[model samples]
Structures are given as C-alpha cells and as structure tokens.
Target: MNLWPTYRCAGIKVVHIADDWSSATVRLKLGPLNRTIFGTAFGGSLSAMTDPFFTLLALKQLGRGYIVWDKAAEIEFVSPGRGTLTSTMTLPPEEVARIRAATSTGEKFLKWYATSIVDAEGRPVAKVRRQIYVRRKRGSC
Candidate 1:
C-alpha cells in the first residue's frame, strides 16, 4: 500500500505480502510526515501502521465466499520509536480452518490477532491487537 495516498502520506509501506496470503510485513519509517515533534515515531503513525494487515490476510485467504472486516483494534505504546518500525501480521492455518468451520453455517465469527511493532533493533515500539469479523456470504453456503 505504499502508493495508496493515506499510507504514502504517512510514510507507511507494505514491505511484503506472502504468496499464499497468510502473512504480511508492513513498515513505517520515521520521516517528515510521520514523526513527532520530539523526533520519535508519532503515536498515530505507530497505530496506523498496523491497521489492516490481519484482515487483509484473512480476506485474501478466505477468497470469494466470505466477508472479512477489521472489527476492532487497540494499541499500546511500549517505547518511543525512532528510525524504522515494522509489524508483521500472520493468520495461522489452524485459525483459518477454524474460521472456515465456524462460518460454514453462515454464522459470524470474531477472531483477535496480535502483532508487535518493533524498532530497527527489534525492541517493541507498540503492541497492537485487531479483531476481525468473518462470515460466509448469504448465498455462498
């Protein structure tokens, strides 16, 4: 999403998305647009960096028959982020299987996923949790 206006303006970049759509790595660089006055990563930027990946992976993996939406989120700032920070989001196979089974009857399922945004040294800058809603499409069952 590097070229997407919101991400681009905030210096957020999608570093990689796995071929199987199971995971993704996103980066936020400390730059003019995303840094706080004290020269650390902006809290909003840190939070924004983690906004969509988990649901994105879920949607891609679930493909055509399901609807996935990022239902909720929370972010805890662990430390000041200088330089670059990265967050990698993954949806495990078992979780996907569980989602499939849970939603097979057209019932909605809510799943929470966590990811740590870390600085260049691998120290945590923020801890983020995202809850996604998944359901089978009405006519797809």
Candidate 2:
C-alpha cells in the first residue's frame, strides 16, 4: 500500500524506503497544518511519523508465516522540532536473524527499536522507542 501521499498531505513525507524493506526514512516538514500553537512541530505528528516503520520492517523480514504487530511505543520530546525533521528506521540483518531464531519454535517474541527525529541542522528533536511483537504461525515454517 502507498502511504506516502496520505502522510505527505499531513506534512509527513516518506522520503525513502529500501527495496528490501530493511530501512526507511521519513521527513516531516513544519507547516501551518502541522505546527503547534507555539509554531513548532506538533507532538502528535512527531509520534505519528514514527508509528509504523518498525512493525512494517519486521513484518517484511519475518514474512507471512509470522504475525507482527506494534506492541507499544514511547516518545520523548527532546527539543522543539522545527523545519524539516527526519528519522530513519533500520532493521539490521543480524537483528532479523535473532528474531527468527527466537521465534522459530513458534513462541512469541518482543523486540524494541529506537530512532531519533532530527531537525534539518541535525539536532535531536525527539526520541522514539517502539516495541514489536512477533510470533511464527502455528502451521507455518
């Protein structure tokens, strides 16, 4: 599914998505619709920008034989976000291997990933942590 248009209309842009679904980069541009009363980036938008990447990446790596879902999330506002804010989510091959090994027996596994939203000048604006739940399907490899 194409989410770029929907997110971009809300001022969040999906700048890049890897062919292998191992990484993705998103940018949120400060605009009237996405600005808070103080004229900075809205907290909800910042959190929303980071909402799906981890789960999506995990699902891709684990394939259809596994169930992947966003279990929980937390965001810390480190500074007032301004200008174009960017965050990149990555799922390294090693991490993918770990998840597969852990859930190979059809047991559930929870994994956490962290990403930082940065301003155009590369200053950290927010820190986001996402926890994902994964389990191998009962009858699948």
Candidate 3:
C-alpha cells in the first residue's frame, strides 16, 4: 500500500502485514505533505493511517464466502505527533471465530475494533475505532 495514491500522498506506508492476515503495521511520516500548521502530524494523515487495515484483515481471513466492509470510524487525537508514527491492527483468533459463528447462519453482524497511533517513543498520538460490517454471501453458508 506504500504506492497507493492515498497513502503515498499522505506519507503513510504500510510496513508489514502478517502472513496469516491477523495483523498489520502502518507508518506515517510527519513530512511537509502530512504536517499540520502547528508542525505536528496532520490530523487527517493520522486518521488515514488507521483506516482500511481492520476491514482488510477481516476480509482476507474470512475468505470469499464472506463480505466485509468498513462501516464507520472515529479518531481521537491524544497528543501532537512528531517524527514517524506507527499503528498496528490485529484481529485475534477468537474474534475471527466469533465473526464466523455469528454469520454462519447467514446473518449480518457489526463489530468494532480499536487501535492507537503512537510516536517513535510509543506515546499515543491518536486513538481510532473502526466498525466493520460482515455477512455470509448468499448461498455460501
């Protein structure tokens, strides 16, 4: 995703996505393109760094029989972000199981996940919450 326009332009780089699709790490550099007037990380960039990760991880783990979408999101700024900031998203095995069981009967479900964007020293810069929508595809149950 480093080359994706939205991420590239905002100075966000996807550092790692686990082989099993259970976790992903993203980084955002506080550069001119993504720096606020206050000389901190731009709020939009901080938020963008977290978007799409949870949904992507869920979809990959759920397979073709399931449909997953990013239903909603919110970000709370905790402090000024300087230098490079990192965020990691993880979908636990139990949570994946829960999602599968919930939609096994062809029911739709909504789940919320949280992550934090932190600076190089591990100070939180923002807290993000993402709501994911999931369901079994018709005839795929």
lDDT of each: 0.89, 0.90, 0.92
Ranking by TM-score: 3, 1, 2
User: Candidate 1's error at 130, in angstroms?
Assistant: 0.4
Query: Which tens-of-lDDT digit does each residue in 1-141 have in candidate 1?
Result: 788898988889999988988888999988998888899998888878878888888888888999999999999989889998999999977789999999998899997899999999999999999999999999996
Best by TM-score: 3
lDDT of 3: 0.92
Lowest-lDDT window of 10 residues in candidate 3? 29-38
Q: Between which residue pairs do clashes occur in model 3?
A: none
Per-residue lDDT tens digits for candidate 2, residues 13-125, read 88898998899999998999999999999998999888899999989877999999999999999999989999999998789899999999989999789999999999999
Q: What is the C-alpha lDDT profile of model 3 across 1-141, one tens digit per residue?
A: 888999999999999999989999999988999987889999889889988999899989889999999999999999999999999999977789999999999999998899999999999999999999999999995
Which candidate's lDDT is highest? Answer: 3
lDDT score, candidate 2: 0.90
User: Which sequence of candidate numbers ranks them by lDDT, best first?
Assistant: 3, 2, 1
